[model samples]
Target: EDQVTQSPEALRLQEGESSSLNCSYTVSGLRGLFWYRQDPGKGPEFLFTLYSAGEEKEKERLKATLTKKESFLHITAPKPEDSATYLCAVQERKTSYDKVIFGPGTSLSVIP
Candidate 1:
């Protein structure tokens, strides 16, 4: 069975603070790892895609990296506007149909 877990289900940070959110997983075969940000009452916005181990992607104050069994999202100098729920998802190569398993997100709150 494939399973994904995230730590510190919620985070509270002062403006300009930096932190890293962790996502650990176990899958039969990993095809891709994805990162997304979701705002209240909105759909998730794609942040990054990692195809293989050691792959990484970055956008503004966010960086996403992948490994054999886990992934990380590093937030640098976050502002109040950066507050959102960060999501981690994975695609399994063994599945016949395109199926992505998502982890419960890490909700981040940045206080100004």
Candidate 2:
């Protein structure tokens, strides 16, 4: 079975504070690792796509890295607007490419 789990269901941070959340996974033949940011009542906005281990991507206050077994999303100097649900997904080698699975996500709040 394919699965992805994230730690610290919710994280509270002050403005300019930095931290990282973890995404653990167990999947058969990973094709891609995806990171997304979602706000309330909206679909996730794709951030990064890690295709292999030791790969990394970044944008503004967010950085995503991938490993053989898991992925990490690091938030640096987060602002209040950066607060949202950080979602991690994995695309496995399935019969259909649309069968991507997502983690529950880490809800983050940045206090100004």
What is the C-alpha local distance difference test score of each model? 0.92, 0.92
lDDT of 1 by residue, 11-76 (tens): 999999899999999988888989999999999999899999998888999999898989999999
TM-scores for all candidates: the values are: 0.95, 0.94
Q: Any residue pairs clashing in model 1, and if so which? A: none
Q: Give the best candidate by TM-score.
A: 1
TM-score of 2: 0.94
1-112 per-residue lDDT for model 2 (tens digits): 6799998899999999999999999998898999999999999999999999999999988899999999999999999999999999988886755468999999999999
lDDT, residue 64, candidate 1: 90
Candidate 2 has which clashing residue pairs, if any?
none
